[model samples]
Target: MAESKPSAPRFAYKGSRLKPLRAFCQVARLGSVSRAAEALYLSQPAVTLQLQALERELGVRLFERSGRRLAPTREGQLLYDMARPLVEGLDGLATNFREQVRGLDAGELNVAAGSSTILYLLPGIVEAFRERHPDVRLTLHNVTGAGGLDLLRSDAVDLAVGSMLDVPADLGYTPVYRFEPMLITPPDHPLAQKRELELADLSPYGLILPPKRLTTYRLVDLVFQQNRVPYTVALEVGGWEVIKQYVAMGLGISIVTAICLTDADRQRLAARSLARWFPPRSYGVVMRKGKFLSAQARAFVELIQPERSAPRDAYASGPSER
Candidate 1:
């Protein structure tokens, strides 16, 4: 009989492929090889090679180029969904395991929040956390709504603190603060002098609003549409501070969360409560469903919501207790 050819290995060791899997997941999360490379602290060529190796090993193209962005293909999405949790668990295992043993003495905590939350809400909480656990490394990622959710989904952030008008099915939000909506105008603006303000009163003056993609803009649009009030947008700005600056310069009035209206802002602009026209915005902590919290993250959450940090059994007894 002719000599039989040796068969190729049917499976490779899982340990050997972990590096490529991590590279693939990072690329998927960041949507670009270069960005992923920067995030992973690796060379772009190295990341590219790892991605190619992963694709070859799996016999599939994981990502597709879409308008200057690398979007995950269906197979890529599936692989990411399956591989992310495993990768995160393995990567975090050492730190979390040590934290569980050492009782929160050392660990890393990553949090995501928008400008408003970081500026108005987090100073005291961050101070308290630093005082309590100075050894723990804490990083605050300044991200907007969609970006915050993206970080939460990719396990980049332990939790996010922000306002959510709509909550996703796979996330849990715990409200920690509530702030009213306010309409702000320059001191000499016509609306500022009105004795009784109405939604229609805003129609004559131009408005400075955040980007249309933001929840604040959508809420403003919905409220105006519902009330049959017409408004004009003079400019679409990004940050509350920038919007305030424009408003103070007589460019346009703006609707802002009361959290952002400090005493300094009150001196330059006139702020009137719009509680009757708009709902109070709730700022909260958001986390992915079933995500395991590290000791350090749990401690921070407790500091943010001390009243809810009661004994576990107290919460387990009934919905009322919870």
Candidate 2:
């Protein structure tokens, strides 16, 4: 057997350079070494020395002094803008940890989620959250897959959870869960009597679904087109809960995911496997190309992470999707 070699020594990023980098960034943002020193609670000479070291390290003049006014050199502006967020983020993370220890942490994870996730998955996530991070506030916003991406681009939401119909050039996705679409029918419906239903089986009954604006419609349509099945849509409604309620009222045959039904919900309706071909609906994590998610947002994501057994049904919206 081969023996493992000792790991190489790693360098610390906070080594002698953090003070200089912090001072240089602050001076650039404030455009005055005196102001930067005051803000940092340091002597002006001390701040100036740190800035000098930063300038020496990069071999560039960071700022130009013009009698009572200081302006960043072109290079200084670039460096400061890039470093500002990094240093601020680190500081924020530290403060958050300290607050957690003192029972005074207050923060929200701005999350965009699909209606189904808001309905079914979030409750478990929120319930377990009290045990793990009691002080962190969780703010969830409802967004369609496409709409969620817009929030991410606009920096409205820190992270997005749902099915993305369009994977834009400036976006990314992670498959957190996978669910298969199934046929939903009233308990008394003829199709409800079947053990397994197929896409070809849908031709006999009218369809009930949300409007085309919803991504589920696209997945359903794609399945119909792929399998060359002839099916006419009967009702195009809004909201999955409304659709399910209508199905319970014997509106029409509907299609939904298995996760959407619990034992109680199942009593009101019948769920059958779609023997017909359809792509698996994957719930995903969507985010902007280069956005930094908040610490709470990241932790929530880890907790709600899909297991091997993906849920297939939904309920009414939670605090997330409005």
Candidate 3:
């Protein structure tokens, strides 16, 4: 046989490609080789070599020096966005796999919800979840819609349970429950006495509403504006309880979702369907687009939507908003 060139070293291409990609992601995230090295528990030279090898393999200049710090180039940023999640997933693979195998025996689940959802909608589901998975540390974060989305995006909460009128491109919203819009006032208020109400009937009264930024406020405003019925907001408040209290005290009449209408609330306030004008609001799970649900999170979600039947509190109010 002709003289054969010495085969390349056996170990040259044997190692996993994940090492360099992991190093690249760390350096991109920290913006400094030394910091990335410390985070990865590797030497600075090793990190530098990894980055160099990654750039050489991809044939791209991954970073450019910005003063004393490193910043990713356009291609670098694109790569970073794609690689970051993968690296994180792989890094947590061991723990996630163990949790998957162990089921809900031991794990933690963090959920975000608005006040109304937490107080009314989640009570039964939460109780059931606790009963089933007591050992699986469960925490429900009380946050508004925007705050909940922020928590979900940052991985601070595994999922969010709330209403979303507008879903973002990078997130997923699956609405599993619906609640009618209701016009609420003190039982003896003029509007409450009418057998049948019209949208124009609400025009003369000042409304108690959440801030103009909230969905409820915007929806109410849109309906009145569309029908050319002029209305005023007497107070811009935050929570459903506070709004209901203000309305019951005759501060102003308000429009609310049935989700907050309980038996106790009905005795204090008269609630009539405003569903004729505004659409029913849908509430359910909100999660990051590509998030990985652990065993604990999956179990909690199952409780929210059981296969046998809806939870006791799924429909918070009775047949009528009366």
| TM-score (all chains, Cα) for each model | 0.65, 0.70, 0.69
Better of 1 and 2 by lDDT: 1
Q: Which stretches of candidate 2 lie over 4 Å from their true place?
A: 1-105, 193-198, 305-322
Worst 10 residues of 1 by lDDT: 313-322
* Per-candidate clash tally: 0, 13, 0
lDDT, each prediction: 0.81, 0.72, 0.82
Q: List ranges where model 3 is wrong by over 4 Å.
A: 1-96, 306-322
What value of lDDT does candidate 3 attain over all alpha carbons? 0.82
TM-score order of candidates, best first? 2, 3, 1
Clashing pairs in 1: none
What is the lDDT, from 0 to 100, of the residue 304 in candidate 3? 69
Tens-digit per-residue lDDT, 1-322, candidate 1? 9999977543243436777788889999989999999988999998888888778777889999998889999999999999999999899989868767565777789999887677766777898899989989999999987898999999999999877878999999998666677889999888889899889999988889988998889999999999999999989988888998999999989988776766677679988888899887777789999998888888888887533321132111111100
